[model samples]
Target: MQRIVLERAGGTPVTKRAHLGAVASGNLEVLCEPPAGDGATIVVSTSVDGYEPVWRATLERFLEQHFIAAAIEINDFGATPAMVSLRLEQALELAR
Candidate 1:
């Protein structure tokens, strides 16, 4: 599994670690922590890169549709924007 840390340093430190992983044929597995408490904090791994806008947009949309509280970490392994987004949501969902 890989680790992607979305950390905002020197300010309102809000770290989101998205543990991402590969899934069966065109699928993904994601787990997230939104910088809070925890209980068997899940970890996900993925492979989605070079698509910052897509990630950002996807996060926004996912956040809009869900609510999270704790740190989130991501681990990617060559995934597409859509896949990344879906993985992110899945992670968040798992968190919830």
Candidate 2:
């Protein structure tokens, strides 16, 4: 049998952009910046009103789980949890 590679080699990091996604209906915008200290900082602002706590909790948990180290600002329109997670991943990937 041939050798198998479980993980690919790492590449040079990229300087991340400031914004991501859209600010329209069913879409959201994410702005990321370098962290001031250790962990990451996530801020969420919604268009349709309320749900601040939910958004905060979800984003906080996502950052914690991923061990991300950046300051992220999310302008949410109406994205689902799954969508938020996926978008966050994408944003971070692009960040790298």
Candidate 3:
């Protein structure tokens, strides 16, 4: 698993970005960082899916100040975004 940590930068857009995730038996084309000329977007695509609002809420809840310069998207494999975030945190902590 790959992870990134974004530092606090002023003038960040705290608003939610247009993001989506899907789970399927087929392979997925994922972009970790933002598109070219668009800067970076934090994406976390998993093999999980189902609960949308929970993940959205998870993103909203965990979206504190230090996470400003980043945008994340997770493709869950039967995993909620909250679970995604929890896994992410654990992964990140382990990585650290």
The per-prediction tally of clashing pairs is 36, 0, 13
Model 1, CA-based lDDT: 0.50
Task: Name the TM-score of candidate 2.
Answer: 0.70
Q: Which whole-number lDDT from 0 to 100 does residue 49 have in model 2?
A: 62
lDDT of 3 by residue, 1-96 (tens): 233233223323333333323354432322233233332344544444444455445555555523433344445455544445664454333322
- Candidate 2 per-residue lDDT, tens place, 1-96, comes to 111111112223235766678977778888776665545656667766665566666676665556556767787788787778878888888775
TM-score for each candidate, following the candidate numbering? 0.49, 0.70, 0.39
The per-prediction CA RMSD against the true structure, in angstroms, equals: 6.8, 12.6, 9.5
Tens digits of per-residue lDDT for model 1 on 1-96? 334334222212224455566555566556555555432222334454455655566655654554444455545555666876776666555544
In terms of lDDT, the poorest run of 10 residues in model 2 is: 1-10
Q: Any idea what lDDT model 3 has? A: 0.41
Q: Highest lDDT among the candidates is held by which one?
A: 2
Give the candidate number with the greatest TM-score: 2
Higher TM-score: candidate 1 or 3?
A: 1
Q: After superposition, how far is residue 10 of candidate 1 from its true place, in Å?
A: 19
Q: Which of 2 and 3 is ahead in TM-score?
A: 2
